[model samples]
Target: MQELEEILRAHAARYPAMEAADYVKLIYQNEFGGCPAAARDGEKERAVPPAGGPLCEPIGGGLCRVHLAALPQGAGPALDRLALATAREAAGSRERFLQKLELLRGLCAAGQLPLDSAALEAFLAQGGAAGPCPPHSGAYQAAYAPGYRVLRQSYADMLPAFLEAERVAARGGVLALDGRCASGKSTLAELIGRVYGCPVFHLDDYFLPPELRTPERFAQPGGNVHYERFEQEILRPFTGGGEVVFRAFDCHAMAMRPPVTVPTAPFAVAEGCYALHPSLRGYYAGAVFLTHTPEKQRQRLMARSPKMLERFEKEWIPLEERYFSACGVEQFCGVTVDTTDLF
Candidate 1:
């Protein structure tokens, strides 16, 4: 570990803009072989498939076939930052950063790192980021309805198709419920959980710890919650059928308590911002996208979280438009449930 840290610090001092791929190559050359090809052959020969199923064959040498099960949502800015930090550390001149990298590698090897939002943010902060991928979007937006009647009605009609798809879990399945904040994704996730008798996981639970939370993020022109951690922890586990422990964010305590082991029942529901990450498309059995006009979404946001309104308006709203709009509910989702129409 000490030797590895020295290598990282030396590399970072020499090449601050070193790509993650290049860093890995350096690590491999220094630790194992001079080339990744030799390392791949050695690892592959000893590679064991994950318990759930066979490993996926990666198209390129960079990504692990096992990682194919993991998906990344449209949280590019956060992810980019994470990658930058990791690259810096991998080639960094700091011993602490190298030590942190060693720890991360250990956690990953042990499969003990919870792939939740907090964990993802920590990973980014520590200097590890997933690949650079484009975000996915859905087509068709529904105008807001005046009352609850339409929303409820729309939900009733849409529930069956969504439920059936989840129950079936056929090839290349996904259920995307896209909506602006306060469009009731949590409520809907609960409803789906109750109806399907499956556990519901909130994406919010994956957010960075309170101490790590930044108001400045909201002030940034296109920043959203750092989602790299969330993708790594919660989303990946949920999609891959790996053992998932439910850990809720304690708003009052502003800390994450230990997770409770969530049962992997026949069907489960995951709800949060960017639940329909492009990489997760084929894995989900069903998708539900909630809709509302920007006005209605804003109203709901103000009603639910007044303090966050400025951030939402100044930061989140535009970020959503720029990053998440392309991956709208309709494009990635098979069933688009218009909240207004149902109520």
Candidate 2:
């Protein structure tokens, strides 16, 4: 628990642009928001949010490891500062707030925060009306300047998928991430690849060539994807644990592109729609279905490709829904993640 606290503090210190008042509020939220399960009397139902920062890889059994050196840059320190500040709400109850007070006391003593011990305690005791910042705040952000935000906002939301990836990796099998078109399958896959160093294969890379897009094929559920080729080129070779070389279908060219090689890893990620088609589902050790509210999905689709929105609304979405219903994609998967808020 204390380790998690220290990690949060270190992360908070990285962003130099954050105001001192915001920093205190951010730290307050961090401490109270993710109080350890042990502190909650061993409750097993609720999940423990990622504590070692956003880009951590799940090791196994709900534990994660953050590799600091692998963290990326360019997202900007302002976002991390703001995210940390607003990531969680104030303590819901007095009891929890008291625990936060204790945690804050420890942090101030350990980190040498400029806050006064007595006045801070008195202010918090009077229902924490300290106006979002601590008094006598110090300029500590420069200690770890020019911080980066590596998917911190969505880290908690991505925990289940991370844990599932760990389980799949342990067994040395493929992990499938299937989802709605705009539901962030590709984003999740990229993040997973970053954290786990796994080979990520996209179903989009196997889109059916023009010749295979016959009316008869379109009539069948999950027929839009070139599963047969995917099986022969990628899944089959991947099963034997070796390099996977496959031709990616070029949608714009309406032809097969040159072959690309993906090196084998402890676990491989198969992502995008139709990834969990019945013919391909059996290969995965674990699968996660990503979904979002219709409104959010449309919003994302518009932002990504405004010209294709009508086609998605009228054609692609219905087809995907049909495949999902006919094949029970959500039910068959071990995890179903609602990524509506994460986006």
Candidate 3:
């Protein structure tokens, strides 16, 4: 967890700009950006062949061809931010209309691809139709009469996890995201920042210095970090609107690097393991604990480190479990996001 956190930040700062391929990879990891093969109509539960799936795999659990065609394209990006807020609302013709309205409004808000408002207004006016979008609805066909949004079966499927963080942030609150290593906390953090236009601080920047890495400190749960320096340098100063600056420690060099300024923003998000330490918990307005099953956690780790299976089994896994349990971090969090159920 410690090394992973450090590397995530270092890479983000090192390559601030992502290429086109990077954009596709990152966006697709979210439910909205990927293919919608997983969606099907409630009225029809016909099984689909594996080769007929969205990405040409056995994905679509059961999708009728008509409903599959009714599923809108491009609208996926628009509904990415709205699906959760709409979940609790009553579902019916009225709910369906509002959902589509929200989608278009989001599209308008984003200044993205075109949406025919007049056509959309008339389409939604008649109450949504089942099956394929009725003719004359313009480009966004299935968007007219929407059902449940299809999730692209990815980490972004956990958009609901950060929805609460967004709510807190909207009210000028600070959010601290702490979770198991490789549980997609950083990915969610980046998604929230992009959507809300907020600045994020990574706890990995405050890694323990070489001098602080003594064996005695390692014995204590999560004592491996320099929370004191992190407090003086980041949390308190940034929250209080004081001069905010801190040096990102270079683990490879075993030394602190040059100073980095914390930009002023309405909402500041701190994300990483041990982010919700008991002593530091009070500083954050909202604390989120992300969790995942050991199986999925190992799969994610193995995806990146094919050769580190043994290392993770013997070293990192135990270390994370010890810290999570010993510090009572789970009990202290405002939310516990389980990533195992996303798929």
- Best-fitting candidate, measured by TM-score? 2
- Candidates in order have lDDT scores of 0.46, 0.65, 0.56
Between candidates 1 and 3, name the one with more favorable lDDT: 3
TM-score of each prediction: 0.45, 0.61, 0.58
| Candidate 2, 107-196: lDDT as tens digits | 666755544566556656664534332322244323222122222334445756876776787678899999898898999898777656
Question: lDDT for model 3, on a 0 to 1 scale?
Answer: 0.56
Clashes of each: 43, 1, 0
Residue ranges of candidate 3 with Cα displaced over 4 Å = 1-156, 341-343
Per-residue lDDT of 1-343 in model 3, one digit per residue for the tens?
Answer: 2332232233224333422222122112121222223222221223222222232111121111122233334333334443332222213243443343464445434543233345434544555432232222221222223133433233235444555665676577578888888887898788667656777878888788877778898887888678888788888887887657888888788888999876777688888888877778888888888889989988888897889888878876677688899988888886788878653
- Residue pairs in clash, model 2: 21-133
Q: Which ten-residue region of model 3 has the weakest summed lDDT?
A: 56-65
For model 1, the superposed segments whose C-alpha errors exceed 4 Å read: 1-174, 209-228, 238-240, 249-254, 326-329, 341-343
- Comparing 1 and 2 on lDDT, the stronger one: 2
TM-score-sorted candidate list, best first: 2, 3, 1
